[model samples]
Target: MSLDAADGTESADRLGWAWPDLPPGELGAPSPMFAVRHAEAPLAPLTLPSGDRIRAIARYEDIRTVMAHSATSRNLRYEGAPRVTKGLSIEDDPASMLNMDSPEHTRLRRILSGTFTPRQIEGWRPRVREIAGELVDTVAAASGPVDLVEAFAFPLPSLVICELMGVPAADQSRFRHWTELFLSTGDASAEDRVSAALDFAGYAAELIATHRERPGDDLIDVLVQARDDDDRLTEDELVALVFGLILAGHETTASQITRGALRLLSHPERWAALVDDPGLTPAVVEEILRYDGPGGYGMLRRMTERVELSGGVVEAGEAVFLLLPAGNMDPDVFPEPESFEVTRFDGTGDRAHGPHLSFGHGPHYCLGANLARMELQVAFETLATRLPSLHLAAPATTVPWIGEALIHRPVSVPVSV
Candidate 1:
């Protein structure tokens, strides 16, 4: 009953076997199959039950090489590829820069880079702090238990992006729903997910139209101009880009905030340290990105050409499923990789920042990294300082986690403020 790959490797431990049927309540554990395979054969031919052959890269350096290699590409939306979702065009149609190879990817990335400049992100500090202050104030008012995911984590990035993209308050709820639909790779029916994606695209089209009619000073307005002036992107490209921004921008931050908070809350000593020295907020955020990040395994990426990887050779048009969390926790690269260390990257005097594969590396490095960093710093500082008594209401293990999800979001993080 186990699937076989081109190399005739057969095992009951295919990556697909780990999902939609993962052992209930086993959240945040590395895929034992992947870990073992990587240890024995860092690159193994994995035969998915769907009859697709994928080269699974698991080691830290190898994974980073594959992600940053010119031969590999994020563009997986062509015909005949093994798709992550059946009805969603994200795997079938041409994607934005995130899913494109260079030249095209670079061109699109450049237009938006202006807004996300380091200086610009730094400028957003006070606003982000203000946002955090407001959310914490509201949580304090509730007095009763509150789910950090819904109350703070979700809204912080959602509203930040809303402000960035100029989305109005009245329309933000709808935006939130569309975002959840597009990003949901767990627990959503294919049909439901597809319908939501269509609705999401439809929503983008409306926003594009509105921006075209009455341009604002937000990123969308800038993108609309890029489409019209520089001819950098087409209308479809513009819509897809904006859609990608909203989808990728908010959910990832939400996961980090919720998961990162939970990690700190669970480790009281670390929590206390952060409270004492707020400067550790940035390093703590980096550690969170490395540890227990939301995006785990299951996202399918295609090989741009035939190449030898680790011990296995993959051909052009073939698909690969990389387990990033596995790579992040690789002992070969990170000493005591499993242990959460805020100062591991921050060396004394020199402060050598260790490479965290969290934001990814090379060309595909996360676009919103600066924004995510700022949010996390403000979030942790505010939460630790404001709600010193904040503690998890439910047992950490009792919280639901989607091991197979494209993004890991805690079902509920009830906390007392």
Candidate 2:
């Protein structure tokens, strides 16, 4: 039954259901309720906490079609468009690439594309590994049980993104506070969410002004030059890009790193596997992306035109939610879908399965995926090599999760090395 959003209670998206019980039970599993939804409602209607009605697609193939098909568009800026949260969602931002459709989306993405290409991110790998090494060293040197989230996961990406933006290391804690409010859906009021956006954008604006006067060699400086020298993007667009990058660039990856470590450590054998053969780190990374990808429900899109699917027909003006993690759970594509095998993506023998939809397909595919992969690879590899005895100090069920916003992660992963 749909609760009136007018009242205070609202419905949760898919991830909310899975998160309560999500440290991959036994053979690395997805939630039973989540699996049931994949089977029964792979394509069904959904309502956001904002009371916006939309269609949710969970099957592997259907999600790919929605992402690739021309009929489904991400332009959520139209009149009476659906809202993803009670307050201003990324879709509501006119300058955000998340809210724009092609040509405009293409233009904004192109400006930053040169920096995030796989080759470009690879060039930054040495520095990333250096950062990860230092973090793991701290965990190793610690005398007592360490909270991985505090000691390793969170700071690794926070430091990396700060370095990229040329922001002072001192400001990260403030950014983290603003980001939590900005992403809040159920746990925050509309005013609080809006306030967070204003604060975040205001800071970005100040940085833009600073870069204009004296340029530095970082992303913010690059963006400032782009706006001043080439006029490639507007003032608002530049701010939106910087704000989005700062928040999205590291937050999700941090969540993934903590969650991945939790998943491996929960199963001692799995942890040993990675420690035994670091060569398997790549495969383990893919499995983690597939089994327990970060964030709520998934990507949201609007139907610009009606499209037919195996389940039913989606009409124009209707919004479609692509449940990326749910799509990754499809048994038809990934054999014995409930269990998460580290080598599931190995593409060897009967283990050969379809590519995981953790990252959306087509043009809207995650721009920072390569950087994220490298971060995960380096983080885990360093953990295995540096702290081979890393094990959960507490039960997985006891781990605390944070993020009242779109992307939720364990607040702490108590571990002993």
Candidate 3:
């Protein structure tokens, strides 16, 4: 199977529409075509801006297989490895665990995993709760329509991740600017994106230096200590790892917060339901991850061996895109996949509804999932409790959506209390 789609090596009719470029349906749900593809073409080829074609594994089971499969490699360091975009994307960083597989990836993941475990994350609950409450108070007091993205959504996670990583509080505004460009697709130019990313890497290096000078009580300190003690990962890898965490730590969570608030606010009953019962916060957060999670472009991998999927057979050395959002939308796995129900996931934790792949599956599952859930739960609970009358400052239609990106986040989420 040739990957070239630019010179007509692959038939145009077989390709799914170029992704990360498609607009989300109402309220930031995945494109309807993703749901349709689960049945019509579970294994679909998608054309990239580079004109290379990668197979999209759209069904829930197929996606799970790809993600958990040992034979599949996420090694994007190969020459001409399928570029997610035309510029220097996160995938281009070979030192990052995101682009590695097996032992190397496993090692780095373990080093950072201990900090993000459910129990460890729970330890930070008080701080996360405090941050959420303070932000809500600020948003509640602000007159006129508040840009939730600026005032609440982005900041809450930004602060949490920064604090967790031991970033200086004063540098957060500049940090936001770099991350904003790093996450942008069409809004920022390729050169601009590269510059921002480089600047970010430099800043991360400085943080590492600071952590080295005075071993503090944060993740960067832990990583710096790990590197000096055991020679775990190289200095460059250290910087990339920290940089990767900073970007992954908050970008999607911020997006989820923005979309989650908008979704609940759009439906007054749902907002009231959460307001009436704070216990419903966890379930609502899960549903938000299911309905509007940062799984837009999905993960990219190449099969090291031929494998049969729920959809079809994938050949060796071929690139495949695991569509996590589509799997979350799988009607078989999640009944009424289109509906936005807070209680969609029962508290029993049964297999009926599922372990949504929004957080992903297997070895590479999201490291910050626990922390992210904590942030979202606290954010939503705080909002509903503090501002029950919260509604979109403008129309839901007026909410700006940035479509062309690896993840989905609104340009600005506006609201009023």
- For each candidate, what TM-score against the reference? 0.88, 0.91, 0.92
Per-residue lDDT for 291-359 in model 2, tens only?
887655687788878888776777888888777877877878887776768877662112455578766
Kindly report which residue stretches of model 1 are placed more than 4 angstroms away from their true locations once superposed. Answer: 1-29, 32-34, 45-53, 77-79, 186-188, 347-354
Give the clashing residue pairs of candidate 2, or none: none
lDDT of 1 at 270: 84
Q: Quick one: ranking by lDDT, best first?
A: 3, 2, 1
Ranked candidates (TM-score, high to low)? 3, 2, 1
How large is the C-alpha RMSD of every model relative to the true structure?
A: 4.3, 4.1, 4.3
Q: What is the lDDT of residue 267 in candidate 3?
A: 86
- TM-score leader: 3
Candidate 1, position 413, lDDT: 86
Angstrom error of the Cα, residue 237, model 1: value is 0.4
**Cα lDDT tens digits for candidate 3, 1-417:** 122212232322222223532335675667666665777778877665445667788898888888888888987767767876667887888788888887999889989888988899989989988988888888888878899988888888889988999987778788777877775555346778899999999999999998888887899988998899989989989999888888877778888888888888888899889999888888888888887867456878889999998799999988888878888889989888889998876532235646888888888888888888888888888888888888888888777766555566678878888
278 Cα displacement, candidate 3 (Å) = 1.6
lDDT of 3 at 81: 76
How many clashing residue pairs are found in candidate 1? 0
